[model samples]
Each structure stands twice: as C-alpha cells, then as structure tokens.
Target: DHLMLYVTNGMGEGIEASLLTNLAINALRNARRAGIPIADQAALADQAVYAHYRGRCYLSVLLFDFDLTNGRVRVVDAGSPQLLRLRRGVVEHVGFEAQLPLGMFEETDYVAQEFEVEPGDRLLFVSDGVHAVASPKGEAYGEAALARAIQSTRLLPAAEVPRAILRELTGHRGEAMPDDDALVVCLDWRGRPADR
Candidate 1:
C-alpha cells in the first residue's frame, strides 16, 4: 500500500486552503503522468499556486509507497522541518530539508527524496502550527517540547501521540491560540506478514 499527504499554510485569507487542496490532487496527476517524484508534484503545485494565487504559502508534502512484496518503504518528503520517527520507544528526527515551500519561486524544482522504515515504527508529521505558538513570555513551544511529547508517549498506542503533542502545546501556551491551522499525522508501520 501507499499514502500521500499534503499540508499547506502561510497563505493570505482567501480560499488558500481550498486552492492547496486542489493543487495537491492535480499535482499528483501531473506527477504520475510525468513519471516524476513527489517533489516534482510539489513543483507542479508551486506553479499552479503562483499562476493563480498571489500569497505566500508553505506546502509540505509526504508520500510513502510501501512495496509490500519486498518490505521496502519509500518515503518522499519536502517542505517540512520536523518529522519524528519512533523506533523501540525512542523518537528521532527524520532530518528532511525541504527544498522550498510552494509559491516561493516560480521556477523552483522540488526534490522528493526517499527513506526506509522498519516494522513497528511510527512516523509523526506535523504542520507549522505545532511550533508557531508564542507565549506571553515570548517563547515558542519549539521542537524540544514536540520531541518530549513523542518520547513520553512512545510506548503508548499510535493514536495517542498527536493528542499528547496537542495537550502539551496547549499546556505550554496557556490560552494562546495558534494563528495557523495545525495538523498532525501519525503512521504506524505494521509490516507485511510472513504468512502472506
């Protein structure tokens, strides 16, 4: 099985989300037709965004195509700073440097890269909102807190990781709402069964 996800923000308040949604779908089609990677899809989306929308927006794309026959997991990602990988109760950064978010450069080329994952591992994807909160004390919740949230819940069920992060974020902010829409996605890899 395979999966693709798109998270976009930093747009002016005029149907930006809708445009990004449409952009993702159309870009996927373009990627398949051109035999390119997700980064190319991002470039396609960027061109579409620049052609129609005139606002600054950040688009983060994550695609993982699992070849169940060989236990190979191909992960393609761009424009996201923080991707957490949980393995055996430990959380580590996936360390993907996004080429650039969509709508930044009209001629930019997005490079979709690949990575491998093991069975029973979890990948946590977050939007910019997770780290964009500024407290009255002027401190951003930051990546350290996010790491802790995942570390603390590494042993728990996969469903609880995002909740714990949000809970911690809210606790740190103490009544300050994030300016952007926040999204969290957790993928748990169970691996292909040998019986198959």
Candidate 2:
C-alpha cells in the first residue's frame, strides 16, 4: 500500500468551498454504494466517521491496491491525478475513462481495471498539481517529465517512486510554492508462490 497526497490552494472562498466538500462526500458515498471498492478501507472508514468535522473542503483521492497472491492491481481514482503503470519497462496510464469528479453530480459510476503485475512492474499515480507546476521558463512539468521520473525509478521499490517524483518536482521548481495540490501513489508487485 503506497499513497502520495497533496492539496493546492483554490480561488473559491468560504461558502462555495463548503458546497464542494459536501458534494464530494456524497459522490464518494454514492460510489461506495455503486460497488467501487475504495482500496484503503480504513481511510475511507475514517472519512465517513468524521466527515462532519471538516464541513466541506474540495480535495481528491488516489488509491492503489495490490494482491500479490493473484497478481492483480486495483486503483480508485476520484478526481485525483491520472495513474501510470510501468510493466516490463513500458509505461501506460490506467484507470476509468474520464468520469465526473467527486461531488459534482448526483450520480456517478467508476470503472476498475486490472492488469497482471509481474515481479518487476511499477505503478505511479500523481496529482494534477504536480503537472501544473510551471518552471521559471514558463513550461509546465508535463507528461514527458513525469514519464521520465517514473522510468528512473523503475528498478526501485514501488513506494520509492512517488517520493522520487516529488523530489524531482522540488528540484524543478526550486523555491516557488506549488500552485496546486499534488500526490503520488506507487505500487510494486512482487508475485508470490501460489502456496504462500
């Protein structure tokens, strides 16, 4: 279980923020009822148990689950960043096709896709804020940099990849404050023997 978390500043103030928070919670509850497994059960449970405390703050969540016994990987992307999976040295994005962000609509559905995770495969999920970071020269960090960041960490444990990306981003931006929230979740699947 590896998760990267980040949140960015928003232009909306006060009341509007509350509305979005409520909407997001309702949307996630709807997703749970609709059969989308949240991957991190404890975290979701905590959110449900204390949802009232925060009122409604807009945020996104990204989850990654790996079942070593079956070589299956499950991800729940809720208005977060796109998740990338690197298998046998090739990198590709995985998750439901574009769906509404949590809390924006009354009813929403999310699709879960599974891919065989070989012993050396790596997966990376990142928040949009990371890609949104702009350099002094004015170019956004974009997909190319992200892909390269993941590739550099291909041989490391799944948990380290996300941190590597964060470090990379920090190096790129120097002292500037990130414009948005960013998070990364990485999972490395090391298959186990059927009997184990």
Candidate 3:
C-alpha cells in the first residue's frame, strides 16, 4: 500500500511553508499512530491547519492511497477541483464534491472515496492553478479544456501527460503567465512512466 498526501499554499501572500510542512508531517504521524482511514486523517489535518493558521492562508490537499493487490485507489480530497481519469480515448473528472478547505472550519468533516484503476489507466491530480486561467472573454479554461488535454496524451507515456496539460493551460491564456501557482501530478499504472 502507498499513501500520497499533497498540500500547497499556492503562492499566497504572507505564508510560511515550514509551518505547513510541519503540520502535514505531524498529521501524518498522528494518522499513522491512530490507524485510521484517509477520511479521519484528513479531518485531523484540517484541525491542525485550522488551529495553527486560523484561515489566513488557503490550503488544498489530495490524499491518495493505493492498494497494490487489487488496484484500488482511496482518495481523501479537501477543497480541490482537479482529479481526473483518462482511459482509452475518453477523459473524465472524478474529483470530490465541494467541501470546505482546510483552515476554514475547525470541525470540518472529510470523506474518503475509492476508485478502481487498471494497469493501463492514467490518473491526474492537478492543483487549482490549472483551472484558474482566463481568456480575453473572461472565461476561465475549465474542466473541458483539461479533459481534452488529457485525452490527447492518454495513450502516450505518463511523462508526457502533465506537460501536455500545462501546454494546454498556457495555450488558453496565450502568452500571459499563469496567474496562480500550478501543479500537475500524473500517475501511470503498471509499465507506465510516472511524471509530474
């Protein structure tokens, strides 16, 4: 089994990264000791972030736990809009329903969900920056754009997936730099190359 937790402050003003890292690490330790599921650990992390930062910063996290035996993927998502699956020739969004971001509420309840992945499946976990792009018409390049990008590269090696998405994101805005911090994570199942 493997667990992946991702947290980023996204170039927010007046933020200290060390504090976030410490809180994440502590929450991870606590989760390990408590022997709880991803949902409980997410709630615990929410409390830690809330108690420490008090909502002065924005936090988005995606927790993924993968079971090697059955190819089951467990997800505990907190206020993120970018979880995608690309299979065959179609791409789909599998993100969690809207939930409170960490540090926004002390008593927020987080839920863990699951997905079944196959050896050739490609999973993408992106930060909000990828969707925070806008055009001259004031429309942000959204999920549809992302799905198209993923579909175009779905059959290639994983190393090319994230790069294609970034290209599509920048393509939406022409020459303008991304207004927000961007992150793209691509995971390829057996025999696929893993890329950022």
Candidate 4:
C-alpha cells in the first residue's frame, strides 16, 4: 500500500498557501492512517478542509493509492491536471470526469477511479505551473506540448523523466522563470517480482 499526493492551494507560496497546504496534508494523512478506502479518501479530506476553511481556501489535489499486491492504482482527482500514462513508448491521458477542487463546498463527493498497471508502465503527474508555462508569444505549453515532450524523452531513465519534462517546458518559456511553482512526479510501475 502506497499513497501519493500532489496538492496545491492555487496560491503562490504565501502564508495562506502554507496553511492550506499543511491543513490538506494533515487531512490526507489522517485519512490514510485511518485506513479510509481509496475511493472515499478525497471526500474525507474535503470535509476536513471545508469545515475549517469554508469558502476562504481550497485545494487542487491528485491523490493516488497503489495496491501493489493487485497491481492496481486508485486515483482521486480534484481539479488537478489529468494524469498521463506512458506505455509501449506511447503517452496517453488518464482521463477523469473532472471534479471541483476541495473545500469549495460543504460536502464534495470526489469520485475515485481505478486502473490496472503492468510492469514498465509509467504514470506522470504535473502541477498547473507546468501547464501554464508560456512562450514570448503567449502560447502556453499545454497538453499537446507536454505529450510530445514526454514522447521525445520516453527513452530516458524513470528518474530523469521529470527533469527532462521541465527542461522541455523551460525551453518553451525562454528565459522567464515559472510564475508559479512547478511540480512533476513520475511513477514507473514495476510489478512485484512475486507477481511476475
């Protein structure tokens, strides 16, 4: 069992952003510690944030729980970037129905979706900062560019993928630093040897 979380308060490194981050992290940690089912974990976190911050603060989250024994991953998305999955040298989007960010409402029921992963499959998650990087001409480095970037560097080692993707995004941005914090996480799924 493994829990991976990517959360952003949508505010850039301010005191409020720090508080919101801590709050969300605690809520998520508590939920996982309590053994909440993967499908319901986001809802539990949502309730916590809503109760404390109400409409004042909210979060975009991509939470993934890996059940290694079964070779499955459960994902709960709240207004984060759509996850990318690379398999057989092809990059594909793992689409979700799209849900509102956490704490926007009193009781937001986040839908958790499950997918099966095979050895050699890679999953990528990025923050909006990566998506929002723009060129001098105002053309944003969106999903198409990101997909191409991932494909172009698909041969790199798993640990190098994030930096490689950032390099691609930076090239698109020219000399400008990212206006927002950028985060990229890559998961290389190598099934347990016992399962093989």
Candidate 5:
C-alpha cells in the first residue's frame, strides 16, 4: 500500500529551494494525516533545509507511501511537475485549478484530488526537470515525449515506467545526469475484488 509522489522545482539556483522544501513538508504532513506512514520526518525536514541552503535550484522528490487501503492520493504541487493518469490506454492530465506552491502561505489549503483507481489503472507524475531537458538541437523533452513514454510503458508495472522514462530521457538528452533533478512516481491500483 504505497503511494508515490514526484516533485520538481523550476530553474535558477536557490530560487525556489525554500518554497519547494516547504511544499514537500506540507505534502508529507497532509499525507500523514491521510494515514500514510512517513519514516524519519525530522531527517527529511533536515534534508529539505539542506537542499534549500545548498542552492539546489532544481529539486525533485519521489516518495512512496506504502499504505493504500483508502485508495486516495494526497498531492501538493509547488510549481513543480504535471500529473498524468492513464486508464484504458488513454492519458489525461489531472488539472490543479489554483493552488499556491508549498510554504508560500502559512494557512494554505491544498486541495487533495481523489480518483477511484480501478484495477489495472496507472498514474504517472513527473517533474518539469525531465521535460525541460533539451537536446543539442535545442528541443525540449516536451509533453509529447512524456505521453509517448507513458504509452510505451503502459503495459509494464508501475515501478518500471519511471525507470523507463529515465532511460528515455537519457537518450533524448544524451547525458547521464540531467541539467535539473528529475523525479518520477508511478502508481498502479490493483483493487480488491468485491465480496459476494
């Protein structure tokens, strides 16, 4: 019962570091409230602070919450990445109407969207860093690439799609390490059968 979270911050060193860290913290807090188990909160907080202090402008986070009896995902996007949902071989983006980045407001209310995941359905979340990676020709990875990657890996298990996308990114970017941190999270809901 693990829920995965993928986060990525935009360009510029130390620009959105603090805000991203705060967003991660808020996301974790909200997840915990939803009954997700987060080990070593203090350590994570420390790492978040360090990420901000080190001026890591491009921050990406992939977290898995291994508790999903509730079939809900709590997500907080702080100007990071886009979330895509795949069902019956079609891809759709889950739109976040108007939510501010984490840590920007003290009493910010992050709206959590819930999807009744059916068996064999998959969800893909990735940071802009991945999409921002460009080739020597100055072409971006782009949403089309993301969509193709997801479609190609749709048959595979949830865990493998992220890795596949990473591999694809390498080929597209022609580098092992991307300019910005790239994070990916794939969630597959193998729902339980209804009792007679």
Candidate 6:
C-alpha cells in the first residue's frame, strides 16, 4: 500500500553521524510502522533526533511516501534537493517549498505536498553532495547540468539512470572523488506490482 523514499544529508561524518543516521532511520521506520500520517513522519523523526542529539547533529532529509494503489506521492522536503519529475520526455521540478533541516530546533512541523504520478513517470532525487561536485574550474555541477544529463539519459533502464547521472557528474568534475558524499536515486513508476 505504501512505498517510501528516504535520503539523509551526508554532510556529517565519523561515529557521531553514523549513530545519528541510525536514530533517524529508526524514528522514521517506527513512525511509519505505527501508521503515523505521511505528513507528520518527518516531524516525529525530527523530535526524536533533536531530543537525542540536542542540536549536536542535524539532518536534511527528503522523505517520500508513495501510494502504489492510487499512484500518488506525498513528499516532505527538509533541505534536500528539489525533486525532478520526468514525464513524456520532459523533466521539471515538482515545485515544493522546503522547510528547515530536522533536529535544528525543539519543535518543527513539516508540511507535505501531494501529487499524482502515472506509469512511465520517473522521479529523481539528488543529494546536496551531487550538486556540490565541482569542476576543475571550481564550478559546481549545478541543476542545469543535472537536468541536461537527465534529459539525455531518460530512455535508459531505471537502474542505469543513476549511473548515467554519476557519469555526467564525473565528466564535469573529472575523475577525482568529490569533496562531499554524492547520492542519486531514480524511481520509474510502472503502475502497481499487480498491474505489472
């Protein structure tokens, strides 16, 4: 009935980040298991993280709740990248306003925006690290380059889309490892499993 997409900011490193990431994952998992509303899941996780880390660790998350039955998606964006939706060969941002990163404050409420998707639609989620990849000339990879890459590779298999995007990033930034962590995820909607 529900599928979820989750990504955390990889800005933090070492033991503290590992522990904080685990806490966040559990918080979100427990909230969903308890049937918490999609809109409030982030807030619940935020409270748990904040209470535990006390501003020592913060997270920028992109939480997506996918309703397979109805072909709708509810997204809570907390300082993550703008979601890109590809439909009929055209790619565009889904247009949701993002709130502050979780664990930054004592009480923070996250609002989710809902949208309908169809078969053949592809959703892309790129991390800040991906955007921050810099060229030898010190230029960031940026959205314009990412969009162009997506457009060029839209026809590839879903599993290969991320690879292609990474290739694009590498092409721009050269062969060196990026200074920050990079994550690129692509979801191709092909209706429900039963339908398939």
> Model-by-model lDDT, in order?
0.67, 0.59, 0.72, 0.79, 0.61, 0.84
Q: Where does the lowest 10-residue lDDT sum fall in candidate 2?
A: 2-11
Candidate 3, residue 108: lDDT: 84
Query: In candidate 1, what are the lDDT values of residues 76-128, reduced to their tens digit?
Result: 45555357788888777777555666666676776656677778888888777
Per residue, candidate 4 scores C-alpha lDDT tens digits across 132-173 of: 789988999988899898888778887999999988888899
Across 87-156, the per-residue lDDT of candidate 2 in tens digits comes to 8878876656443344333334445445566776665667777877888777898888888888887777
Stretches off by above 4 angstroms in model 3 are 5-18, 191-196
Model 6 over residues 1-196: C-alpha lDDT tens digits?
Answer: 8898887883488987888878888989999999998668889889998998887778888888889898988888887666788899888877778787888888898899888999899988888778778999899988788888899998899899999898778889887767877788898898876744
By TM-score, the candidates rank as: 6, 4, 3, 1, 5, 2
State the local distance difference test value for candidate 2: 0.59
Clash pairs, candidate 5, are: 1-66, 1-67, 2-65, 2-66, 3-65
- RMSD of model 4, in Å? 2.1
TM-score of 4: 0.89
Give the residue spans of candidate 5 off by over 4 A: 1-76
| Candidate 3 local distance difference test against the native | 0.72
Best candidate per TM-score, number? 6
TM-score against native, each model:
0.80, 0.64, 0.82, 0.89, 0.65, 0.91
Q: Candidate 4 — worst ten consecutive residues by lDDT sum?
A: 3-12
lDDT preference between candidates 4 and 5, better one: 4
TM-score of 5: 0.65
What digit string (tens of lDDT, one per residue) describes model 3 on residues 48-161? 878887776546777767777677878777666477887776688885666666667777898778887887778888887887679766788888887778877877788887
Question: Model 5, residue 102: displacement in angstroms?
Answer: 1.6
TM-score of 2: 0.64
Candidate 5 or 1, higher TM-score: 1
- How does model 6 fare in lDDT? 0.84
Model 4, stretches more than 4 Å misplaced? 1-10
